[model samples]
Target: EAEVAQSPRYKITEKSQAVAFWCDPISGHATLYWYRQILGQGPELLVQFQDESVVDDSQLPKDRFSAERLKGVDSTLKIQPAELGDSAMYLCASSHRDRGPMNTEAFFGQGTRLTVV
Candidate 1:
């Protein structure tokens, strides 16, 4: 099966530095999601997009984080002024459909682990 693509499996940076991650969802997928997983906690949706349109981003920290899905396919997430608390696993997920909570598998990437010191 074709898989979602993510870059820089690991990232190490100093506080206040800038960091970015990239992801490419599976072909034909209509919905893409970015999540942040802290330690043992479940992932929290940072942003969600449906064919280049923002579906929900209430939890996204707009001050320092920004994301875009140009062309409605590949997406990128960037963080400026990184904080120590920002250290966590950044995951990218994609689904074929988002209209219903039906039984559909959400494919996740290996995730980009960011470490801020």
Candidate 2:
């Protein structure tokens, strides 16, 4: 995955606190996604948006994790009362959805590494 733009390269927080990560996708792309990857594991989809409308968020832990792509430009992922298991790389990616499902290339960002103690 080619890296896009992400903020706060790293974060360290204690359990039960809130943490947030931001991502700016490639210009003109209409599809955005958020993923979490544990150490030594591939990224797992958490949320997906197509022009600010949520298309899929089945994998998202809605109880504590929330994602949004407002205005179809940038996106944000927030975790409230983070647990120790929440520590992982939060990746942001975008693709041209018009290319058809699973047919477009997705570019990822240098994920935010969240550490919950």
Candidate 3:
């Protein structure tokens, strides 16, 4: 079975520092997504990418956060001047089809946990 891969399972950074996380979605999956999960809340979509182009990023904080999937296969998410509120789990997911009722399943990575101090 194929699975999404993420680097640096854990991260700790200062409030004003910058942090970045990497993810490699399953091969052949055309849709990729980045999500943020606060401790007790459900995952929130930050960005969605189809191939090398962005499909949606309405929830991503353009001022301090950015996500890119240049080659359309792997991606990176970065946060500058990290804030305590930014501490959470960053998850990457992929699906073979576009987001819709037909595409009910998505494979997700273990996620990268960020902690800001």
lDDT, candidate 2, residue 113?
94
Off by over 4 Å in 3: 99-104
Alpha carbon lDDT at 108, candidate 2:
90
- For model 2, the superposed segments whose C-alpha errors exceed 4 Å read 1-3, 100-103
Candidate 1: count the clashes: 0
* Prediction-by-prediction clash tally: 0, 0, 0
Best by lDDT: 1
Across 6-113, the per-residue lDDT of candidate 2 in tens digits comes to 988999999999999999999888999899999999999999999999999999999999988879989999999899999999999998877555678888998999
2 or 3, which is superior by lDDT? 3
TM-score for all models, in order of appearance: 0.95, 0.93, 0.94
lDDT (Cα atoms) of all candidates against the true structure: 0.94, 0.92, 0.93
Candidate 1: clashing pairs of residues: none
Residue 39 in model 3: lDDT: 95
How are the candidates ranked when ordered by lDDT, highest leading? 1, 3, 2
Residue range with the least summed lDDT across 10 consecutive positions in model 3: 97-106
User: Candidate 1 on 30-80: residue-level lDDT in tens?
Assistant: 999999999999999999999899899999999999999989999999999
RMSD values for the candidates in order, in angstroms, are 1.3, 2.2, 1.6
